[model samples]
Target: MAPAITLAAEAPKLSSANTGFMLICSALVLLMTPGLAFFYGGMVRVKSTLNMLMMSFISMGIVTILWVLYGFSLAFGEHNSLIGWNSDWFGLSHIGLTELWPGYSIPVFVFMVFQMMFAIITPALISGALADRVKFSAWSLFIALWVTIVYVPVAHWVWGADGWAFKLGVIDFAGGTAVHINAGAAALGVILVIGKRVGFKKDPMRPHSLPWVMLGAGLLWFGWFGFNAGSWLGNDDGVGALMFVNTQVATAAAMLAWLAYEKIRHGAFTTLGAASGAVAGLVAITPSGGAVSPLGAIAVGAIAGVACAAAVGLKFRFGYDDSLDVVGVHMVGGIIGSLLIGFFATGKGQSAATGVFYGDHTFTQLWKQCAGVGAVLAYSLVVSAVLAFLLDKTIGMRVSEDEEISGIDQAEHAETAYDFSGAGGGVVGSVSASALATAAQTKKVDA
Candidate 1:
């Protein structure tokens, strides 16, 4: 190991090349949040499109402030089992920090910001399950609080050096249990507490725009590069290059598997099917990709894609109203990734773990993986239930019936997405000045 240095050691000595790459990596993670916004926004009803977008954008603001405030301290600060001791902001004012990853010279702050993107998006993804009903202000407050209380602690446990799980030798290269499973279970908990939206099952509510859905899918796919690759914490070295390749292959394989399954079962290739499958691949690879072999990644991704696609239908059977399939995709994909690693991981140069393929201590590793999954589900559900109850009783959750029916865009924001029909009926080009004046007045009045 390189020489250990004190906190007083001059600012971390990173190469210019490493710093440039890290900056790009940080941008990559930031991109995922907006990518998430598009992904969820397309899944909601037309009436609540803007509100759905707001739900995600709000996370960028709320989580950023919270992460800086106390969330970072609770997560990464040095201290005990339950929480961190609020060490200096990972050397905030130092201009750089010693690289934490193996053989990297990048600053610690670079890694922190990349992870921050994930912290923001995980909760934002849950908003899909609770879409179109919860009060906007209440949501803003809930996610902020949830991240600090639930997310930070768990992140500390899995990722922080002093985290219990990390100390226990549980390997989560990325956040399988911490991010995906935690968010998915928490989504279910909050949705149950908030209850179903009006006519959730009775009404055949369809997505307002499929084009928007496809666009969001593209963005998510693009941003995921930073997500899986940036986990390397530096340049395209052995680990980073390997993760980058695995991510691409697994996603392609899962996409193919999903389509093949659908064609055999449903007789048609749906765009939504392809999008869902791609995300499932991404999630399944998040934790295990760097550890597992290429063949292993393909196996995990394809299985997760097919399994998640099937799981999405369960809401209709079980009647939970997980409006946007958060449970099906994130929860199921996370379980697949976390467990598959036990069967697929192998001892490499510095990585001493081995899986069932190696036929050594397979059961023990698998058991450990299962336990991690169980812990996240139990903790997130219980904590989320309490939080949701508080919000429901205090500020209330669902909107008024009048507001609900009119749609959040107009009901809450006083705006409609499209306004082509005027007294100059179906007029594409021109409208009377008086009508234009009236429309402007109506918009101002509503605002």
Candidate 2:
């Protein structure tokens, strides 16, 4: 007003081709939810299939709503290192905001919706590690709290306009450390606190369906093109094309490595193993892909596959039942990718700050990466714990023993997924029946 109320000039417009590309990328990412459903559904008992599917589907709804409200602004808005306190709920009412942010072709609001999908899937991915137990109310609350407390800050720290890591030149082209490693550690924390499911090591808790897992893997793989490629903000850039190539290269390598490992260790490459391997590869290359060469991505994928395989067996050693090995795949994969960038990433003049394999400032890059890992892990763990504590104290976490004995689908949702032959119901079927059977035998022996 003092300056005559002159408005800033309108933002420049992106070409139509670029806008089309971004929209396609957005749609591709939207596919990840169903892919996630298949991934988790295959690992869980048949009795809890619907419950597992719901965990992923629910995220598509809850996170989208939350993202529109404040998650996006908090995550991507123009605030400081820790968090963004700009734009109240849905404050970004305009479209095609190129003047404010030059690189993106799409409106900030559209970009927010697109990234919202990422925020949704990352938390849902962790749910795999907690399958078959945990109340829906509690699960919903856990996710809501975890995303707000752990995910938003970590996301801002890594990708926000004022993120310190971005300023310090930590190249996370996608989200190796932020989404994969962050979720993996948080998964471990929650599983530790909640304890194991009823029949963890002793029971033959094999996946009820392998086809579902493969399907999920397939879906996740397809969607990753968007997850990695979309990071470019628009398709016009060469970096975006490179990211697309890396996504494919890493996923394929991970698949081959995982199958070979399974063939050696378990005597056959199971469908579940293949699906898991693909995901592991995707996680590993997320942070380093666009910055590195094809060879680098392959190396990253191969090592991530092997390392995640080894880590998955740690459940027997460390005694923390990471029910679906979220800790193994995502955490280890993220670490591998984060560390690999030190040895792999190079520019036109690789001589100046070259990786060790190229013989330069390799060790320095690795050290910075480790620091970032430590910060993200510590922050996620502590914040997740605090949030879990608050929710538990305030509204109560964990279902009752009775609910525990029954499948969450029936206990929490008041419905069962498959009533194949009128055998499944609220209390007289599936998990409930199993619990009752166990109780009756115990009573008989005692009597």
Best of the candidates, lDDT: 1
Each candidate structure's TM-score, on Cα atoms with residue i matched to residue i, is: 0.89, 0.87
Clashing residue pairs in candidate 1 (N, C-alpha, C atoms within 3 angstroms): none
lDDT of 1 by residue, 1-447 (tens): 111234645434566777677778778777877877787788788789888888889999988877766676678776875577555664354333555432356665665677778888889888888888888888888997789789998888877767777666566667888889999999989988988888988988777776777787778778787787777675534777777877887888888888888899899998888888898888888888888878888998899889988888888898887988899999888888888878888766115677787675637667777777888888998899899999899998778878888887776667766666674354654556668889999999999
CA shift of 338, model 2, Å: 1.2
Residue-level error in angstroms, candidate 1, position 50: 0.3
* lDDT (Cα, 0-100) at 255 in candidate 2: 83
Query: Taking the tens digit of each residue's C-alpha lDDT, what string does model 2 give over 1-447?
Result: 000112346444555676667677778888988898988888888767888899889888888878877887788776787787565435455444553244444655556666787898889988888887777788897888788888888888887767776556566767887888898888887877777877678887888888888888898999999988887776554778888888899988998899899899989987877888999999998987877788888998999888888889998898888878899999888988888877887752211344557654438776767778888888877776676666667776666666655776787777776675554454466777799899999999999
Model 1 lDDT, residue 105, Cα: 67
Worst 10 residues of 2 by lDDT: 1-10
Clashing pairs in 2: none
